[model samples]
Target: MTANAFMSISLDPPLIAISIAEKARMLGKIQASGRFAVSVLASGKDKIAWHFAGKPNPELHGLFDSLDGLPVVRGALATFSAEVRDEILAGDHTIFVGHVRALNWDSNADPLLFFKGKFGALEDTRKAPAGMLQIETELMW
Candidate 1:
């Protein structure tokens, strides 16, 4: 399923979280299989994104590429296969917490992104790849 709500949840153990509507087909599959794969679509792959978002494509009928038995989108800029770590009920969505198992990435490719109400591409204003952004840790009173 196409995720609109997802984020990296941790740094030490490398975790990610995605919230899916409770009744979505993807949720059932995740529950049954105990695993799922995340593919970060490269820029200009909105067509592929829409295909997984429920629009049927006649030619590539169910053309899901796989690595280590996990279904992934071909040509993704980055991909990860993860085992389900936990499931949480978050109002109308079921949050699937995943523990990173296998990973792949291509830093040279720009990411496909959705913003506001439209699909977009990343514009690197910095003009160079920068390392992780640093934020000061908060101190408890």
Candidate 2:
């Protein structure tokens, strides 16, 4: 549940792929419902990320919100509802190719970033406009 193997596979017709573990409960739900949602958290929602990643932090309690019955991170930068288009087996995960059905975003919001086995926030650099902010401290284990 904490895994994030998702990627944008295409722009034409708005397609995305989420790699879910074969044993992930969410995978079963997606397959059963034929739909899924992606919520891209904004800076300050690291707890939300950790929460969904299967390690709920008590300090982040009550951080979850919803959109049309889909669990969404409160104050996320973006949320997308999609219909499952295809499923492909990949090693120990199943790649769920989704056709984005609806999407919403806040261009002004900085995104929560994950990389290199750590949770971090985007660092505003000369290449990007100023004012990127951190929600939670960079954490690695």
Error of 2 at 138 (Å): 35
What local distance difference test score does each model get?
0.85, 0.81
Residue-by-residue lDDT tens digits, candidate 2, 1-141: 555676888899899988998888888999999998888888877777787788877776556677656776667798888889999999998999999888889999988888887778877565534677646787899
Tens digits of per-residue lDDT, candidate 1, 65-119, equal: 7866998888789888889999999998999899988888888899899998689
- Candidate 1 displacement at residue 83 in angstroms: 0.8
RMSD of 1: 9.7
Taking the candidates one at a time, how many backbone clashes does each contain? 0, 1
Each candidate's TM vs. the true structure?
A: 0.82, 0.80
State in Å the error of residue 118, model 1: 0.7
lDDT of 1 at 15: 96
Question: Which 10 consecutive positions of candidate 1 have the poorest summed lDDT?
Answer: 124-133
Best model per TM-score: 1
